[model samples]
Target: MWVVTGYAEVSTALTDRRLCKDSARLRAIIDRATAARLDGSRVAETVATDMLNSDPPEHTRLRKLVVKGFSARRIERLRPLVQQITDDLLDAMVARAADGTVDFVDAFAFPLPLTVICELLGIPRADQRSFRAWSTVIVGSSSRDDLRRTTTALGGYLAQMMSAKRSAPGDDLLSDLVEASDTDDRLSPLELVSMACLLLIAGHETTMNLLGSALLALLRHPDQFAKLRTRPELLDAAVEETLRYNSPAPVTTWRYAAEPMTIGGSPIATNDIVLLALGAANHDERFPDPDAFDIERQSTGHLSFGHGIHFCLGAALARMEAQVALGRLIERFPDIALAVPADELRWRPSTIMHGLAALPVRLGR
Candidate 1:
């Protein structure tokens, strides 16, 4: 595996057609590495067939079919809904802060985005809690048994949900997808299930981590936090800076070299599994004092959401979510502060995601 860390090189690799995201090719490379022909489980294989694992025109088609559900207009319409959710969650947090402390991760960060995505997908409120456990294992676990178990569970749940949507369609994203599949065959059954899984996982996981990491960064840097509170207009810049400083998605999903190429003057052979370190590239010499957490800095061009064609489809939604969640949190809880020492916090164990395991904050401080 080749790891590309330089900003310029990683940026180049993101768009270069020579690097591909075809899952079959990736599996072939893995098979060669392990010296065995390994067939993934049905659930695993179906999940891997999402747009995130395909190349154009397959990726292009899949993205087109799903992008309408997350259009700018749709996301904009969701702001009021997002604000309501944030306010409700904050009310609960205030109620729970009788002891003056609350785990922001549980109280606000995780549920805010999760609720939005779940509602958009028409998932019942009762079933929303179970997703946290399934998502944690799907993204963070290293054991094959753990992964298989979690994916099977998630996939089975989605299959049942899609089946229900087919019989009685609802005014939800999943129903629209089901209609598309059943009407024109634009989406196969496996593809529909895989896409739903992708939307459920990717829709909330990255945004959840972004909220946690953003709060952690602000709390750790009092000056920046104060600046945000005083000059509320800087909320967007603050979110962008947090994305560069501690990107939720630290590294991108795997990319394979379609042909021999040189990135950062290093030779990458065909079929080499390449990992682009978004976190590292964001801290590279491209920006002045890249290590400094300056909300006022020109933090544009950061590859936290990635670049080129494969850039995150939920970028607009995630940005709106962070801005709304953080802006309201600071406005409401002016006395919020870290409950424990900054160094005492621990990040979840995941190579691809950067997020705090827990963010204990004194809401009344």
Candidate 2:
């Protein structure tokens, strides 16, 4: 495995066609060593065909099928809805804070984005609970059995959902995806299911972490937090700085070497998995005083959303969601502080994402 941490090298490797997204090559490597039964499995079908694991033509087609729904204009229109959701969650947090403490992660951070994504995907609000376990395992599976079991279940649920969407199409994005699969014939059933899983899971989880981490960053830097409270225009910078300072997705998903290639003077053999450390790259010296959490810092060139064609599909939505959530949070709980010592905070153990397990806070009583 080749790990690229330098900003320049990570950026270069992102656009390099030599580094492929095909999971089969990497799976072959694992299968050879462990004798894992991956071939002809439900997990294999979903992982092998997802847009995140395919090269051009396939990726291009798959991405296009759903890109229109996430367009800047489309996402921007959700601002009012996002603000409403943030306000509702904050109201609940304030009510809970009557006792002088509340778990921000559960009350606000987790639910805000989760609600938005579920509504966007046309998933029933009641059924959203099933995703927590499945998504956690898919992103941070401890073993092959865990991965296989969770993926099989997730794939099955998505298949069932897509079937219902076909019968009763709606204004939601999943309905749009179903139309593309049935009428336009642009997406296969498996591809549709995989896309739903990818969009629904990736859509909310990363943003949830961003909300949690961004809030944690502010609480740690009260000066910066106060500065933002006084200067509303700095909200964008605060959000950007938070993403650069403490990235939500710590690393880009695995990219396999399609052929022999040299990245940042380091030679890589074909089929080696290339992991780009986004958090490390974001703090590279290329950006002056990278460690400082200066919201006013100009030129925020972070790979938190990645670079090249595979750049996050929901970047605009995530940005909008964070901007709204953070601004509303400060407005709602002006004196919010950590309920426990900062050192006591725990982080979720996932290589691909960096997020606190819970953000306990004293939303001023």
Candidate 3:
């Protein structure tokens, strides 16, 4: 077995120029178990965006159009609303709980981010179930037939939503993107559709998993959960710690090295695949007792949001959403507990994301 666990090696590899995030990388990797069967066309069609695919200057221009709105300052302004959304979700969960037993994920974790994102995007409340189902198939499992169907249906719906935003602006990211496309970079209709597709899925699914994984970790380590509940101020740090501890999009993303670079003395060729193991990186010895979930740990160096110019554009929004969601969760259900055993829990077999199929949890005070 080959061993590779060091901050320097992983971070250096992630920021290197040798790796690339081209379509070929995903097509081959999506199915080591099934790839011998999928034709290149079928796989290439799944991911349609400049956000997760393509390098600068396409990435640079496309990212610039929306990055301004998601800056730390702007996201900070959105925090109170995030808090409200979190509170509302927890309220619903608490109302539904009977004898202290409730599916915390369905009750709280999943809905918090979904509701916030839908509100932010101005997606109609009535359409959430469809959006959730599509995102579930896209991120939860990677069956070729299922992914294609979800992608097409979801993409078409979001494209229409973007069209609506363009025709009649709203106080949401879609409107902002429409104006950005019209005035600033002149993004074509298809490009805008692709961007919407990226935001809708990436925005919702990642945060959903973040809450689930973080809550699971806390449940497994009840002492830490209590620490968070007792110290309200630790909420922000806890969010970052949870991100580093078990990032939602683990084992994927940041799949580029700009050119040939050497990592751990292993030569990676130009355009080679560079998979940053966020989970492994978080546990690297260089980070000091890496397994410990110390919310107080000055973890600004963490790569849960990634690094360099291509770092996740929505990092601030992600942080704000998770902080409010997790913070409110602990507030409403201080005695929250996992209703299922860890080993018995099923995980999404998607090659791109590391997330649970479902989180069975019960909430109480």
Candidate 4:
């Protein structure tokens, strides 16, 4: 296994066709490593069929079908809903801060995106909480039993949801996907459930981390926070900088070397599992004073959302959610400050995600 950390090398690895993402090839490697077939797990089998695990033609078809349902217009139309959700969460946060402190992650960061994504997917509000638990386990848990249990539950839930949509479709992404499944290039039942699971997990998990990390970044950099409060136009730039500085999805998923190739002069052999460190690449020497958190910096070309054919499909949605959520929080609480010392902050223990476990803050002066 090789970890590519240099900016140029990570960028190259992302676009290079030699780095394969095909699920069968990846499963073969995993099976070899574990000396057992992974097919015994039903949840694993269902989840493995997503676009993220496929190559060119298969990936292209899956992405095309999903893109139709997750259009730019669809995301843009949600701005009002995003704003409403942010405002409501802020109101709740303010109310809960009666003791002068509140866990922002619990009150705002987590629920805001969860609500939006659930609503977008046409998931009933009652079931949204279950997703939070399932997503947390799937992304953060180290226990295989726990992971299998949670995924099995989530897979079953999605199967039921898809069935409901089939009988009585709604004007939601899932229903759109159900309609797509009925077409000529239709998604198989496994693919349908897998795609929904991918969207459901990726949709909120990344954005939730983004919200928490962005606010944490601002709280640490008082000057930048103050500057954004006064110059609201920098909201977008602040979100971008936070992404580059503390990437929510810190590393790309595992990619296999289909053929021997050199990345930044280091030779990678066939079948080598490669992990591109997006967080490291974003902070590489390519960016002037990369360690410094400068909202005004030209933070373009960062691998925060990745590169090539696998760049985040939800980049626009994540950006919008962050911009709305962070912008509103800053606006509503002019004197918001960290409730504890900056050094006391703790991050979630996961290589795939960089996010705070909690963000306690004082909402008022």
Candidate 5:
């Protein structure tokens, strides 16, 4: 894998048409055995057919169809609801920490975003667990067999959900996606399932990391935490800084060279899979003391949500969720601190996602 870690190269790689996102084209360049392995699975094919896996005009069509549902106005309208969810989850965390300590990840970080995304997608509360389990496997699982099995199971569930939506539509994003039909163009059945999988998984998973990592960052930097505690107005800066300090996604999904070209002065090659390290790029020497976590730092030009067309669709929602959850938690428990040594905390085993496995803290009274 040709890894591009410099910010300039990563940014250029994102918008370069030469480095394509077409799944079929990418698969073809891989070893024939691996390509066959991926192609052999129906679940893989279905999930790979979505906007994230395609290049324009297919990507353009899929994006246009989905972007309407996540307009700025619609996302803004969700702020009150997101605040309510955050408050409720914090209330529960308070109760759970009657003993003065609790696993923050279990009580707050995971559930907050999970609940928001489920509600946004109109998924039943009871189904969130299954989806979570499936998503866990798809995102973090190392075993190929396990990944394939969970993806197949998740795809089956989405297929059923889409069928139900067709028979009886609702006022959710999925319904909007289901009912969306363009001028002689519409999302195919597999494409719909793929899109749902993408949204459902990406919606909560990325933000879950953002919340977890942001909290962890604050806890480690008490000075910055206290600064934000005093000036809640710095909440937005804190979020941006956290995104840059430890990008929720350490690396973006792989892109392949469609034709021979040079990157970072490297030799040209067709179909060379390039991995852009968002975390590394965010901390590149291009920025002054990039490793230091400073909310006051100007955090523009970071590749946290990526660059160009494939930038995260739910960036606004993710920001809102993190802002509300972090702001409320800190406000409610000013004395909160790590329950265990900082070094004891374990990060989730994910090369792509940078998140703690659990964040244990004391909710000082």
Candidate 6:
């Protein structure tokens, strides 16, 4: 295991040209162990649509295409949509909670990101269910068997959707990617499928967990929750704090050394699996007052969305969605409390991702 103790070291590891993280090479190692559980046929297989699966020129190309759909200007415009989704979910929670009890996951955490991504991607109403199921397996697959079946099925789904877009392009991210791909063949049929899957997994579910993690932390820290409730404008830092306190995907996508490299004074060998601990790096004491959830902590940068050229494309969208969702969730239901004890809420058992299994709560009497 590669140890990274400082922000500088992590940053260097990410941007360093010395390190290599070609997706296929790393996939071989990852699937080697998990292949028995995932289909044996896919044992050496890599995902078709993942950004983490590419290197250099391809990485830069795909990142730029994804960025086109998520520019700061575009994300700023998405604020109203984020707020609208927040309001709609809170309203539904109120309607469902006639007696003042609601599963916060259903009422808020799940729908907010789901709706926003569906709108952002311009997924047809009819195809939403397929996307949802595909997303769950792509991002939330419970077991290896589940991952394989879903991978094949979702690949087919994306291929079919791309064909539809080719005929009748809509005003969604897929269409944008298609148009961009027309000029640049970086997004081939396989890559197109991979990109679609990447969008849903990265663009949707992770944000759901981001909002959920933030809400869960606030509820557990009632004093902090109260402070945020009183000062609604502190949302940006609050969201960043939650990301630090409880990283959604605690371990980033696994990376292996392309060649022998030194990181944090350790000589990592070629093909060594290095799991970047986003949660640990965020809490490094090097970053003054690492644990105190200060709402004004000048949250300049964090690895919650990741680092380097392969940084998250949906980051701006994720930030907007979290700020709007958490800010309004508190504003609308100030008394939102966990139906179960904080200790009883189970965390997803996945080794890579971290999130709640369920988040039931009482909206209030």
After superposition, the stretches of candidate 4 with alpha carbons farther than 4 Å from their true spots are: 35-40
Give TM per candidate.
0.98, 0.96, 0.88, 0.97, 0.96, 0.90
Residue-level error in angstroms, candidate 2, position 301: 1.4
For residues 1-365, what per-residue lDDT tens digits would candidate 5 score against the true structure? 79999999999988988888888877777745253445445677766888988899999999988897778998888889889988898888878785789998888888878888888887888888887788777778468778888888999998898878778988889888888842234988888889999999889988999998988899999999999999999999999999999899989887888789999999758877889999999999888999899999999888999989999899989998898888888889988999999999898887778888898999987
* lDDT, candidate 2, 265-306, per-residue tens: 988887778899989999999989999888888736898998
Estimate the TM-score for candidate 5. 0.96
lDDT of 3 by residue, 13-99 (tens): 566545666555544554453626555552234455555676667777778787876767777877888888777777777677677
Q: Which runs in model 2 stand beyond 4 Å of their true positions?
A: 33-40
Best by lDDT: 1
Of the candidates numbered 1 and 3, which has the greater lDDT value?
A: 1
**Candidate 4 lDDT by residue in tens digits, 2-22:** 988999889988999889898
**Can you give the lDDT of residue 159 in candidate 4?**
95
- Evaluated against the true structure, the overall lDDT of model 4 is 0.88
- For candidate 1, write residues 219-311 as lDDT tens digits: 888899888889999999999999999989999999998999988878989898999999999999999999999999999999999998889
Which residue pairs come into collision in candidate 1? none
- Per-model tally of clashing residue pairs: 0, 0, 6, 0, 0, 1
Q: How many backbone clashes does candidate 3 have?
A: 6
Judge candidate 3 at residue 24 and give its lDDT. 52
